[model samples]
Target: MKSLGVIVEYNPFHNGHKFHLEQSKITTGADVVIAVMSGQFLQRGEPALVSKWTRTKMALLNGIDIVVELPYAFATQKAEIFASGSISILSSLHCDTVCFGSEQGNIHDFERTLAIMDSKKEEYDLRVQSYSQEGYSFPKASSMAFTEITKNDRVLDLTQPNNILGYHYVKSIGEQNSPMKAFTIERTSAGYHDPDFNTTTIASATSIRRALFNHGGQIENVQQYVPEGTYQSLAHYQRQAGGFHRWEDYFPFLKYRILCSTPSELAEIYEVEEGLEHRLQQTMKESHSFDEFMTRLKTKRYTWTRLQRMCTHLLTNTKKEMMQRITSTKKSEYIRLLGMSKKGQSYLKQVKKDTDIPLLSKVTAMESNMLNMDIRATCTYAMKFPEPARSEWMGLEYSKPPIRYNEETNTFI
Candidate 1:
């Protein structure tokens, strides 16, 4: 069966995501949709609002036929690593194409951009350096340099969060020169960072998250935009105590990590560039909140998201060594299963014989093994919720079931 690949967070499944999935299937005529998704942590360095199991179930309930965890290291990393990790996993699955949402939506333009970057990398790199030297933030400098090279007005907005990642996706795929075809669907919804929910066709995940947290919007109103199972899941989670709205609940842990960290130790953390370490140290002493600290550190030379991701890496004890290693490495020989259907199962078996990677559908207690260690670390943190809730969350790994596919209808159950 032909499979179309997607890299997702689903942070919570909503209408826009469902549309993306449906369009990918229709456009590619793909028999199966496989997703490499974020786990406990997301790409931007924030904890997922819901557990991966819950999100996996939601993905299955929606249109995805298979879901594989993106792995915590890659899920919470910068664009390059994020794209590389997702791309590697999809390629390993022998997927025929990768479909993603983008602002430009024109695959030709993306291809053109990639060609320009590859051919004129040195000049572009020099221009980016010049802009950074002139006090422009990384994102701004890169965007400016890219626009100067491409002479496209829309390229200026290329630095927008989704567009940036989409660019990296194309770049990474080009570098790998894999057989997977690439396609994009134009994004139809609120802006990536917008926090409003006033839309009909689709709403941004940011807005949906805000509405869910604030309890100000009605889920039924956006019912058509989201998968029914996802809507039901959110409703249930909302009614549960200690809702997932506030990410700052973990602030104390971050503060503790910052407080206990030495300058040398902090220097070794990913994104801890020369003077940035000192600034973070100083901010730790003066700032009272994550938002405030980020505000103080934000400069024209570094985007807010970059700084936030850096801080998150440091707080999570993600060593610079690990980041470097993953970047230099070309492949992941293991597929950490999040969930999958029967058709997915059949596809896996077909590919497994020829795949260069191991397909891991179950976790084992092997702390010494590097691959299993990663899974263990995620499980360890996931099991840390308050009291009885912690036990319930931890037990999901064993109790939460994998999806079974129905071959007759060519759908995942």
Candidate 2:
């Protein structure tokens, strides 16, 4: 069975995501759709709006046949590392193609851009380093370098969020020498970072999240932008977990973590570089909330996303050495199954014989540095919840089986 792979957060699995899944299937002409989703923390350094299990159910209820957890090591990193891990998983699964929604929408442009970068690799690296030394954020430096090197409008635009990710996806595919073909569909209606509801049905996830958080966690506020399953999942998660996950929910704990840790200790955390430890320790004392802390911490050298990711690392006590050891290898050590439909089960059966990586359904007795990081991240994310819910959710890493979705009954078994 041919499979098409997608890298997703599905933070609430809105209407635009459903459209992407549909178009990916049609474009790839694959028999099954596999989504590699972030676990507790997303790429942008924020906690997921809901748990991975809840998001897995949302994917299964939508058109996705299989949902696999993107390990924390890769899920929280920058674009290049994120794309590398995602493409590696898809390649390991023997997916025929990987599809992404992008502003450019054309695959050739990405190919052209990659060729240009390859040709000007040394110069590009030099410029990026120079700009970084001058206090520009890495993404900005890279964008500026690309513009200077390429100077052609025909190549993919690295400034657009989706296009930047898409470019890295294509680059990873080439670097890994994977068999999977790459495809992109034009994102409809909403921009990736647009924080306002500009469309009736196809609003960005950012906008939907903003609405939900602003409107007292009311699912009805963003109901028009997401599917019925997503709406139900959000409502159910809110009721059961007491509230949707957000940075603000854990700000107090983060503040405590920073204040108690010594500068040297904070410096050991991943992404905490060049005296940022002292800044974090000093600013966290005066800031009462996550928003306030971020406002105080923001600088031209560090993007808000970068600082948030750094804070996430600090909150989880993820040391730089630990991340380096985990990410030393090019591919993930295992494929963690989160949920699957009947078709997905059949596909798994077919692929398991030749699969190179271990396909894990449960965490019991599993011992690996990468998997341990995922479990640790789960624990950190669960701590913000109250009472029984906190312990119950954290224990899920050990006890919860891969959710089996019954397509016929439209329910998880």
Most accurate candidate by TM-score: 2
Task: Provide the overall lDDT of each model, using Cα atoms, as 2-decimal numbers.
Answer: 0.74, 0.91
Q: Quote each prediction's TM-score.
A: 0.89, 0.99
Cα RMSD for candidates in order? 3.1, 0.9
Error of 2 at 50 (Å): 0.5
Worst 10 residues of 2 by lDDT: 149-158
Q: What local lDDT score does residue 147 receive in model 1, on the 0 to 100 scale?
A: 83
Residue 38's lDDT within candidate 2 is 95
Error of 1 at 157 (Å): 5.3
1-413 per-residue lDDT for model 2 (tens digits) = 88999999998899999999898889889899999999999999999999999999999999899999999999999999999899999999999999999999899989988888898899999999999888899989998888987885468778899998999999999998998899999998999999999988999989999998898988898989999999988888888888888999889889889998889989999999989999998898888889999999999989999999998998888999989988877688899999999999999999988888899999865689899889999999998888887898899999999999999899889
TM-score of 2: 0.99
